[model samples]
Target: MIYEICVDSVAGVRAAKEAGAHRAELCANLLEGGTTPSLGLIRAARRVTGIGIHVIIRPRGGDFLFDDDEYAIMQTDIAAARQEGADGVVIGLLTAEGDVDAERTRALIALARPLSVTFHRAFDMARDPFAALETLISLGVDRILTSGQEASVLEGLPLISELIKRAGERIIIMPGGGITPRNAGRIVQAAHPKETHFAALTAEPGGMRFRRDHVFMGGELRPPEFDRLVTSGQIIRTVMKNTTG
Candidate 1:
């Protein structure tokens, strides 16, 4: 089973490589659901890790619908990914009607040229996943990163299995979202996919930073937070050894 870990920063990408992750989904602002990382980060990741770098080509945080300008930005990002020696590009786009925007996606794919393309999780929000998968395959997408149309993979395993079966040799069905080491094996067994994606971060015991003097109008601290694991190199190595052994 191949493990594709999400990395929101250059440090996270390096950590993922140390942990034995097969690939890193390069993005920024994970809190905003992952936007495109900067060109410098992309180049730095390539120089630092030999593992596959799949750059997320998303322009912003909200909604999958892209304006013409955003679409143009995606095109530039795709070309930049290629110039940076990225292995592949991950992107998602939908029509205003909540369906796959095949025409626009095809345009981006054409610009991607030599790099592989994996349609991102915008698949989960589609009006009809099965139909959308068909469209992605027809567009020659290398893969689809989906959560089976639910909040988590465990909840969507049944549909994911169906998608895998339907996909056959046409395209790859890569499952993501809430995939943990404990359930990774189970999901792989159920979906029988060629790969899987997960962000395995352990709570860092006291990593959240805040100003103690800072308070809201009511004189209460905003909220306490904790540090989360960015998927340590050690964890990745152990998981890989366990899974591949």
Candidate 2:
């Protein structure tokens, strides 16, 4: 099985490589479901890890329906990912009507040529899963990361399995979201997918010896100021063992 880990840092990429992951989907602001990472981060990850680095090309978080300005930004980001020597790029776009934006998506795919392209979890938000699958196949997307239009992979296993069967040799259907070591084996056994994506993250205390507890950097829904999430090599290793053994 191909293990693709979603990571947000060069350290995370290194951890994934040491733990035997085949690839890392590099991103930033993962709390908001991942955004395009900085060029420096992409370049550093490429230099530090031998595993494939597929950068997420999202300009911001929220929905996959990007405005024209955001679409232009995505195009620029794809070019930057290529210039930074990234192995692949993950992207997604949708029409207002909830279908794949074939026109814009096709342009992005054309720009990402030679580099592998993965249609990200926006597939979950699509109006019709089967129709979206066919469109992606026709657009020549290399793979699709989805949770079967549900909140998590476990809840979406039935649809994921069917998508894999339908895709056959045309495109790859990669299951992702809420995939932990505890359920990794079960997912593989049931879905029988060729590839899977997940983040084996652990929270670590940030490096701040002194802090003002009363202050908040973000708005109402803010994360803890002194804690940060990082990928755990041990967790990845355990998941790998559970998945294949």
Candidate 3:
């Protein structure tokens, strides 16, 4: 199976390539799930990694419900990804009622032509996975990254397997979220998906020697201010070997 390593930095993309991954999904702030990485980051990753670089076009974290301006920003990011030499774009838009935003989705897919388009884990948040699958298929979505609408793919294996069976060749169902080396084989065996998404990330101390911990940029539980997340090459290799072995 082909693996798409989720990465937040150009460094992670390089690590993925070194660790035997087929592609890397470039995003920022993986803490908030994943937001659009900076254009500079996109170019840097493209330059450094020969493997495919699929950029996540999310404007921010939180919900998939986007307003008009946010939608416009996503469009701009898609265009930028294309111009900046990304291999594909990952995006998702849901209506207020937790359904696919067909019109908006179609528009983005059209804009991302030639380059691949994956409807991201926003599929997991849909009201009905079956209905969402139909909408994506009708829109010509190339692939879908989902966790089976549960906290993790393991919890949603039944639905994931069913979706893979029902989708047939019409759409690609890629399992993502909380897939570790220990469970990668089981997930692949159960879901039987062509592609899989994972992040072999670990926290390392930040470069700053002198630190101030009084203020927190994110939530209280976030890693100490001096700690940052990075892709673990060893973990990536282990996950890949287990899943594909």
* Residues 148-213, model 3: lDDT tens digits: 999999999999999999999999999999999999999988778999999999989899877777
lDDT of 1 by residue, 1-245 (tens): 77898887677788887777789999986767799999999998898756889999999999999998998899999999999999999999999888999999999989997888999899999999989999999999999999999999999999999999999999999999987667766777677788888776654555445545444333243223443446566666655554554
- Model 1, position 215, has a per-residue lDDT of 40
Candidate 2 lowest-lDDT run of ten: 41-50
In order, candidate lDDTs are 0.85, 0.95, 0.93
In model 3, pairs of residues that clash are none
- What residue runs in model 3 are displaced by over 4 Å at the alpha carbon? 219-221
- Which runs of model 2 end up more than 4 angstroms from their true locations? none
- Of candidates 3 and 2, the better by TM-score: 2
Model 2 C-alpha lDDT per residue in residues 1-245, reported as the tens digit of each score: 99999999999999999999999999999989999999889989999757999999999999999998999999999999998899999999999889999999999999998999999999999999999999999999999999999999999999999999999999999999999989999999999988999998999999999998889999999899989999999999998899899
Question: Which candidate, 1 or 2, has the higher lDDT?
Answer: 2
Candidate number that wins on TM-score, 1 or 3: 3
- Best-to-worst order by lDDT is 2, 3, 1
Candidate 3 local lDDT, residue 3: 90
State the local distance difference test value for candidate 2. 0.95
Which pairs, if any, clash in model 1?
19-233, 19-236, 19-237, 201-229, 202-229, 204-227
Q: After superposition, how far is residue 10 of candidate 2 from its true place, in Å?
A: 0.7
RMSD for all candidates, in order, please.
3.3, 0.7, 1.2
